[model samples]
Target: MTLLGDAAHPMVPRFGQGAGQAIEDGFALAVLLEHAKRDKIPARLKAYQELRLERTSRV
Candidate 1:
């Protein structure tokens, strides 16, 4: 299974991005999944990770 937001990268309370990041992760994953083939799940997830990691790391 794939992880998202706090589950993937929990942050200190001061960051105040737990919910927002979760939402962003879910939305991005959903969009990717929509166009992804069943056999391409791994690739899709990797894409999601790369996309979110770049954005979340800055938080």
Candidate 2:
């Protein structure tokens, strides 16, 4: 459940959205780090994975 960006989606790096997902991951990680929270790690990661799974899979 440790999702990290569009590693699943893997866009063409066009429109600069490819790395956007990674940036979002970074932000999310930052928030969790700052709060020392781990409760939602698995769920959040799973959600991120699901979000990018189809989109990146097609790309």
Candidate 3:
């Protein structure tokens, strides 16, 4: 399953990009998920983590 919107990234909620970025992440995750089934959960999650980490680290 993929999490999206504010449900995924609960940021300051003032940047206005939280929802937008979450949607972007959802789409990206969907593309990643389509490439692999549940077997790719680890990798998919890793990708999400990488993205979130990168974004958060930038903050």
Using TM-score as the measure, which candidate wins? Answer: 1
Residue 25's C-alpha lDDT in candidate 3?
Answer: 74
Q: Give the per-residue lDDT of model 3 (tens digit) for 1-59.
A: 54665676667758687766776777777776776877878888788767766664454
Question: lDDT tens string, model 1, 6-59?
Answer: 999897877568988899999999999997778999999999999998899998
Reference-based TM-score, model 1 = 0.89
TM-score to native of every candidate shown: 0.89, 0.46, 0.61
RMSD of each: 1.2, 4.0, 2.4
Clashing pairs in 2: 9-56
Clashing pairs in model 3? Answer: none
Error of 1 at 9 (Å): 0.7
After superposition, candidate 3 runs with Cα above 4 Å error: 1-4
Give Cα-based local distance difference scores for all models.
0.90, 0.62, 0.70
Q: Lowest summed-lDDT stretch of 10 residues in model 3? A: 50-59
Model 1 accuracy (lDDT, Cα): 0.90
Order candidates by lDDT, high to low. 1, 3, 2
Query: Which has the higher lDDT value, candidate number 1 or candidate number 3?
Result: 1
